[model samples]
Target: MTPPPGWYPDPQAPHLERWWDGAVWTEHLRAPEVPGPPQPAGGVSGRAKAVALTSAAVVLVAAIVTGVAVLGEDDDGGGPATGALPTSVPSTDLPTPTPTRTTSEPPADPDAVPDVVVDELNGITLPLPDGWTPPKNVPEDDVVMTTDDGTYECPAGVGLCRHGLVLTRTVTENDEKSPETLAEQDIPDAADAAYDRDTLDRRLYGGIESHRTVKSGPVAVAGRAGYFVRWRVKTADGPGGYVQSLAFPSSVGSESPVIVRFVFDAGPDGPPLADMDRITKGIRSIGDADTGGGVGSSIGPTG
Candidate 1:
């Protein structure tokens, strides 16, 4: 960026701010007006200008793509402690808002939801993976955590993510299937929810555990209390992926022994969770085994 026709060069800024000496635009200092951008070079037609602008836009788009790709492999996406891995879920204080029957976070069609699986605890269907070989019954004091995409503290196929951590919890719930009327216990919070990586089920990726809450319209889950959710957001960085979960609480607080969920970090399905267009096209909520819900679902809200 050369300065056009300066007056004189300032003694103090000898090598720097030079000034136009005089007539022939000398390097002398004076009260000269700031020079504007140079005019376009002479061209035969205006096509060159248009082409230049288009090229600039293309370059910007390309740069974004490259940045994302590079960051995607950066493990933690350069976030806090989560740092490219999932963390542990500790017993802690969670949102204590009253649960409502809202469809703000309704589970989607089972077919559309990937990574989410269902299992049977007693007779009621529990949400688990086909391959998750648990100890059969989860303990009451057992710690819980959930994630979006990250290494699973548990086995890969289970609710645990094999990629990154998220902002949800996973509890075996002492093998007790949730009754229609839950006694309603207090949940944990961030400080209590925080757990070490070792305590978590390390999947392919490493990170922490998470928990979330919602409040909205209700959806029936196999004759039980249920709600339709707008979206499910999880982090590849374990629990406490607090950003999006605040959107709803009731739709997410289910006591099922196992709950299946899909994790999303990037793409159109991230941040506040996948949009309705993508979620409806993917998530599926199964009913009883007698119904299409199968061993995978306890009949949560359907799309």
Candidate 2:
């Protein structure tokens, strides 16, 4: 038998009620009842009311006497009855509290994390956050990928690249250089090429100038030493752009060491630094002992 309906529990929101128009669900929703202000005192007979008034007077008198006694004990003569109970006099002009509408804000969504992808040739893996396309095979030992629909353009004079997220992975034989040396020298040099003020300002930001290297520092990646660098380009008329770069040596001591670099660019909207940090932590070599890899202990790089 079909049940007549007015409102029923919403399948999507367990605690909320949704309107059912006897045949189908409606968009209308019914908010849960909120408690109201306390009610005024009531339900007393004339005789009881008189008795209550008498009892209240007695209590007030007793409180006043107690206060007087306390004041008498103070060595500095007598004082006002500070502890006396106040008498409640009925007033027709007194106002009742009015009810006000109130609502609670909805909860925020959970933080998103990236997906992990392994470069079969290098035995290394890194996270590819949600909304990003899977890695596509590239020439030689390189793979490339991007966020889905990750294309954006800064007006002509703002930045070099007008686009969305672009991630590239290229594994080159480690030149036996310490990660520090590689980061200290190579990252700065790369930043110079990527963010030449004249070239960028000439194209974007409407002649408004901005500097590079908002922040840079040492960071560990995939259980190995690495470096992180960030650059910002602000335009006079637009939201601006940000770039983050990271590089680490895949196999620290192998005869054929590998260097891995990951760069992220967010135009105007800015980069998700925290999400990027979490992604960096998730990076790992498929076979390194420190990172649960099959490789045993390896020698540390010498200066």
Candidate 3:
């Protein structure tokens, strides 16, 4: 194409520095005097700026698309820029604790059952009242387990007597109300009943009473609970009277303990509550024994 008139040439241009005129080259193509904005970094041409801007927009769009894909996969609205709402978390479910009970089994004949702690249930025997038959088996209920206690009885007319005691087991929840609290309810009531029968009835009314006793703290039964009591009422027969009970808390129920107790009118050979305690101290938990609670002897029964 033919150059037009008045076109100028630029000496600064690396190539094609000349401007076109209607007929031929002219030296009028001086570089423009006006200055441009600062050159791009690294002195790149202005066109490179446009290319960089387009590249940035492309990257931003790619990020948005990637985030959208991630949000679709989770469907949990975890991705930012998805404009999605979050859902509430569901509450967790937990397992509940179960309760256990124990029962008493008859002691096997030494000939039939080996004479060991397992057979004994780590049990210590007590004297049964004359002619009174010990129940075949202790009832199984909330108890952990029951042991054979021969029998228990107090003579009519009140002076001397024999008693049998059986120990049993029961499990309790860690958070449940303690056995002491439960015992406080029954213990005072039992003692009060005995007191009314002995003091008000016998001492005041019947004219055959002797004395009374004060409140005592809870006692321990080997590895069990213990409670105590006192008898002030003496018979017209002789100078003899005593009181006792066990009130220890159960290891199983950190909240409380099973209340164990024994009471009697002093006899010629007075009931063996004292000796019973001596033997009880010898008890050991079955868990510690050779048997896994099968055949071992101890004062404390393992829970």
Per-residue alpha-carbon lDDT of model 1 for 98-206, expressed as tens digits? 9788567777776443343333221233332322222222321221223333233432233432221223234344543442111122122221222213334333223
lDDT of each: 0.32, 0.48, 0.37
Top TM-score model: 2
Order of models, best lDDT first: 2, 3, 1
Error of 2 at 201 (Å): 15
lDDT of 3 by residue, 1-303 (tens): 332354222222311123434544444433222223566567767686687666656654554455346445432432221222224312223367898898899886664422223213323332333322333443312122122334233334543223333333332434434444544544443443332344324431123354555444443444444443433445444333343333344333232444344333355544444543443343344443321122112323221
- Lowest summed lDDT across 10 adjacent residues in model 1 is found at 242-251
Better of 2 and 3 by TM-score: 2
Which candidate wins on lDDT?
2
By the TM-score metric, which is better: model 1 or model 2? 2
Stretches off by above 4 angstroms in model 1 are 1-118, 122-217, 227-303
Error of 3 at 255 (Å): 5.0
For all predicted structures, in order, the TM-scores are 0.25, 0.43, 0.32
Q: lDDT tens string, model 2, 166-217?
A: 3433335445445545554554433433333333235443433564766666
Score candidate 3 by TM-score against the native: 0.32
